[model samples]
Target chain A: MAHILVVDDDEIMRALLSGMLRHVGHTVVESDNGQGGLEQMNAYPAELVITDIFMPEMDGLEFLITLLEKHPDSKVIAISGGYKAVNACLSLQMAKALGATDIIAKPFHTAAVIRQVAYALQSKTIAYRRRAER
Target chain B: MNASQSEQIQNTEEGYPDFAKLTEMREELGDHFLLVMQHFQSGMLARPQKIRQAFQNNNPEQLALEGHSFKSLCRQLGLSQMETLSVTLESMGRSGQLDGAAPLIERLLAYGLQAHCELQKYCLACGKPSSVQ
Candidate 1:
């Protein structure tokens, strides 16, 4: 099982995601806001990071940028409810461009998310294998 | 599209029952029913006490904050009825209508009980005994 970090400003969202992740047999660490999320990532490395776009203190984009700077190999799954249309769209595009393995929209279907997470983990394994070969 | 056609189309898309989606999520989350239960329990236990305290102190701001938090949690848990009640409570708090909060609080409590029962049923079905918080 992979270690996963879930970050969202909404407490319920965090709880729901954490419950889902933990239920799937993955270890989950949660943070209520972007800044705290970033801190947790640095302190406790996770194989995957799932973050919400709009948040207090630091937004998801800023967190993503900082995270990549520190750990380019980290896999990220960005999620958003599209509450902020322009910003969310832009951030999603940026996340894809910055090498996030997947992006799931908010109110996501559970199976789709699970599939995407599995795909990302598999891809990460492949990348690590290639790196080892090099 | 004409108004009637547009309305029909909107309803068709929006009225798709969420049961299938919820079921898929439940399966994907595997045995993590316990975590969801814990979240529901925390919300169920904390919200009423916070609301009661706010009412006793006559603190509208605190009431509004608590209502907002409760509403957020309800929405997250897919507790639509409770979310609606919490929204009404939030509005009353915003308007400083403390007298209007009691009925809304009662409705919220009723919904909370319903949610608790639903969670319990889910646990029992999973062969896990309900653990009260």
Candidate 2:
């Protein structure tokens, strides 16, 4: 029911996430990377953002840093595949410190994705700032 | 914050992928299952050249990126064997140690080809005709 932005370097991830969101009746906007995500947010500001951590031009951690700086109220979800045992928790912890509202590990189930989106929407204050409301 | 990764991690015990998970996804996604698989064929597997180049050139950064992307996509589709191989490749690349990576890359390629065939057949049997190459 809310406008959501899904950002990831993977085209399939963008397609999969946007498809899932659309199935649940949420309007979705997709971007290939964080820089593109920032531009999309500027053009079609969404209430929620789901992004991936490792990417070419701009990674998710950097994006979270930038996004939170620009729109501190925006809800952000960071997704990462994580290498073996070494950077799984570390990567996510970095994301949290950088201001991601939530994080999702790669290869997640459909229900899990839907649940996180719902929780972020209902419990947390939205990231999208209406000009009039702000 | 630990709750963010509450979902169970799915991987295969054997050398192949668990298609049952994908079957469930097919039911939920219906026609859009085609789109996901299509991306698997076209978008995901479209760059073996880059992967090989990274591995051969000892470009740890590129190798890690390739491994990260490949394993992530494979896990999503339940291709656990390939996911396992890719994860190893990613770890090695991240650590800047490609020692013994040759055999791993070869196995990943072999498994990847098998996975592609299985996915093609699966999609064709799913009521919609596929133009897989």
After TM-score superposition, the amount by which residue A111's alpha carbon in candidate 1 deviates from its true location, in angstroms, is 2.1
Candidate 2 at A80: error in angstroms?
1.4
Task: List candidate 2 segments past 4 Å from native.
Answer: A83-86, A126-134, B1-15
lDDT of 2 by residue, A4-90 (tens): 999988888888887778877889888898998999988878889999887888888899888887877888888887754646568
lDDT of 2 by residue, B1-133 (tens): 0122111122334345567877866765666778877777664345444566799998987888888888778888887667666767777788888877777677666666677777778888887876767
For model 1, the stretches where C-alpha displacement exceeds 4 angstroms are A9-12, A54-56, A59-61, A80-101, A122-134, B1-25, B48-73, B87-102
lDDT values, one for every candidate: 0.68, 0.76
Clashes of each: 0, 1
DockQ of 2: 0.44
Q: Which residue pairs clash in candidate 2?
A: A74-A127
Q: After superposition, how far is residue A99 of candidate 2 from its true place, in Å?
A: 3.2
Candidate 2 residue A92 C-alpha distance from true site, Å: 2.1
Give the lowest summed-lDDT range of ten residues in model 2 chain B.
Answer: B1-10
